[model samples]
Target: MTAIPAVTLNNGVTIPQLGLGVFQIPDAETRAAVTTALEAGYRSIDTAAVYGNETGVGRALAASGLPRDELFVTTKLWITDLGRRAARDALRASLDRLGLDRVDLYLIHWPAPATDAYLDAWQGLEDLYAEGLARAIGVSNFLPEHLDRVVALGGTVPAVNQIELHPALQNRETAAAAAARGIATEAWSPLAQGAVLTEAPIVAAARAHGVTPAQVVLRWHLQQGRIVIPKSVTPARIAANLDVFGFDLTAAELTAIDALDRAGRTGPHPATFQG
Candidate 1:
């Protein structure tokens, strides 16, 4: 089993630097994918209600036979679940599906700024944290302004801000803002949906290190202090993704990759996305 490094959250909770993400994975395939990842030494699993596969994830966890403390699971509340009562109910439903009493981290799936209820949604998360239903609460796809608003609203500073990030979309400003407020930046599309693997910089770096382009990219995220979740259902790829802790990227290689950033984003814009 690879000894994946852990990053400490704002509230003293720690998360594995690398995890398996079940985004876009079919419900029938999620269990096998998660099981492959766990057997490959992955201790963290990121899922959400929107993914519609939490039930499969729960089954995998139960079958893995890994102790609760040995695994880190994360799930999110959808935009419709904003506000105190709705948020709590949504989390309970998610817990029931996940077959867990609590999650390591829970996040607002999106700012959904158009609805103007993120503040209320965050407050609900705060209540959950207080009630010990969630060890750490945070937001996802939030821009700097949205994060600032949450901080000003007062409660717990988000333990993390999960967003679409990769070499093509560096998202430096959002990351900087989160850093200033002691929030960890987690990369959702860390590989750019396999769009970056063939880029010259990544390919060259992979060649130089005798590793795969995907490994190089994952290493880049780790070197930059960003937690990354790369999703894959293929057994070989799932194991390959977790094998990134073996090498380090040189400063110049990191810079070359950084220069590949074109401010391109594969997901919805947080500033305008309603759900």
Candidate 2:
């Protein structure tokens, strides 16, 4: 854990570069999975209002007996809760569900770009951050246009932008925009939903590094300066994912991965996120 690095956000806050993502993790398994991650030395946990397991994650955190400040928790606002007032109420509900008086980082899960309400939703987050209900604020799945809006309105630049990222969908432009604005980048599906685990280069790199293919890929992201959240219910994989601090991928290896990018996304596109 001590060997893991930290990324400085636009607000000058330092967060763990590698974190645990509990996306689609069943409610029954959420506690055990998050607890396993925490015990294995992960201090940052990324969840969302839509994930439907906030209570379980909350219970795990409470039961772990770890000091709150040492842990960084990130959660998001759902599309249905996009208006200013509705967003405010939604965050309070999320706080109640997570059993946290204030979250470390909060984000707009998606801009719902089709609608014009994300700006209002972002204002809600800004208000929350100003009132100390959230230590930091950011967005998720926001394309460059959405980010430009956040900046144009004249408020705090997002501390991070959690997005769909993997070797197959590198999101170079979005990541570069975030970097130019000093926003930290977090990858939600760093493993590509297990679709790329058997890719030749990943497998070869895994053998070359004497690590699992997953670890090799995660290390590649780490070396490329991206925050990653690799999810797993299995304890061994959870432990292995956090063990990436020990290695660094070569520039050529990273270039090989960059070439693997199909500009293909396996998940919903941000521009089409209606809710």
Candidate 3:
């Protein structure tokens, strides 16, 4: 098994650079998918309250018999649960479903800026961190302005900022903002949800490296110093995604992929997304 490198967060906690993401996996099927990843050497699992699959994740964790300290579990607070009190309760509920006392990481699922409640949510996360309910806290889909406000609160800075990033949508602005704040950038929808798998640049790189296009793209992300959680239910892909450490993309190859960005965003823009 290839040893996946860990990215040390600003707070000194370590997170696996490559992990399994259960974004759309239904509750009934998430356990098997997670189990497959764990068997293939994945220790990090990203889930959210909106996904409604934490119980399934709990089942897989229980069956794996992996020590609690060895696994990195992450869950999020939804927009409806953005206030300080609501955020705490939501995580408690998530922990109940996950069958764990503390999550490795917890995040505010979305900024929902219109509601202007994320600051309260961040405060809640700060309290949770102090209470030892979450080892680390972060925000997802937050733009630069949103990050600034969180930082201005003078509380715990976010350990990670997860955003929709891929060859088609680099999201460099937000990524840069996160970098400036000493926050690790985690790329979700890293393959553009398969939209970039067949691009000429990726295909050429795949052929040159004798790897799949998906592998080539994942390598593109890893080489750029970003955390990626590519989701796949196929057993072979689950194993192959972790095999990216065996290859490296050349500078020119990386640049070619970088040029493929077209501002193609599959999800709602964080600035105006109410939820």
Candidate 4:
């Protein structure tokens, strides 16, 4: 057990700084992946309705025998379901599939700006939060402009903003904006999808720390106060990802990694991504 640190969101709910992400894992494979993560001492599991594996995640959680309160489960509302009522219905459906009464955190999967339905979705999330169906609500892949608009609409400020952030794509500007509004930034691709594993800085740091490159990259995210959900289906990698809390990355090492940022976004642009 690595004793993963917890970050208290703007609303005062605490989330584990590191968690398991079930993005591409299929429904059948998701169960075992989540099971491996649980057995490896992970309490948080991040999934999206679009991922199409909440049912498998739910099955694993139900079978774990761990108290429901001890786990932090998060799922998102897909772009297709962006209206207020649609978002509400979508969550209920996700809840039904997950076999849970309420999700720890519910997020609008993306801004989907072109469609102009995110504000409505935000309202639905607020309604869910008000009714206790979602403990906390947030938006993912939202840029600074999107965040500003959501704030202007004025119902509930998002507790977290999930984005594609890694050493290669640090996304500091949006992160700063989220921080200014007291929202925590959650990094989805914290390891650059393995693109940065062989970088000289990361490799050097890993060798110095006697840890793997993946662990070094994860440690970089953790050391900077960002919440990370690194996805890995392999049991060894799943267990290794959580073993980053023991060592600290030096300031020079952090700076070297910071210099690696080149706006290399691994996902679609939020402003234009309809889905």
User: How high is the CA lDDT of each candidate model?
Assistant: 0.94, 0.89, 0.95, 0.95
Between which residue pairs do clashes occur in model 3? Answer: none
Q: Which structure is stronger by lDDT: 2 or 3?
A: 3
Question: For model 2, how many clashes?
Answer: 0
TM, every model: 0.99, 0.97, 0.99, 0.99
Model 1, 1-275: lDDT tens digits are 89999999999999999999999999899999999999999999999999999999999999999999999999999988988788999999999999999999999999888766889989999999999999999999999999999999877999999999999999999999999999999999999999899999899999998999999999999998999999999999999999998889999999999999997889888888876
Total clashing pairs for each candidate: 0, 0, 0, 0
- Which window of ten consecutive residues has the lowest lDDT sum in model 4? 112-121
lDDT of 4 at 163: 96
* Clashing residue pairs found in predicted model 2: none
True-structure RMSD for candidate 1: 0.7
Q: Candidate 4 — what's its lDDT?
A: 0.95
In the range 135-245, model 4's lDDT, one tens digit per residue, is 889989999999999999977999999999999999999999999999999999899889999999999999999999999999999988999999999999999999988
Please identify model 1 stretches exceeding 4 Å from their true place.
Answer: none
Task: Report the lDDT of model 4 for residue 209.
Answer: 94
lDDT of 2 at 60: 94
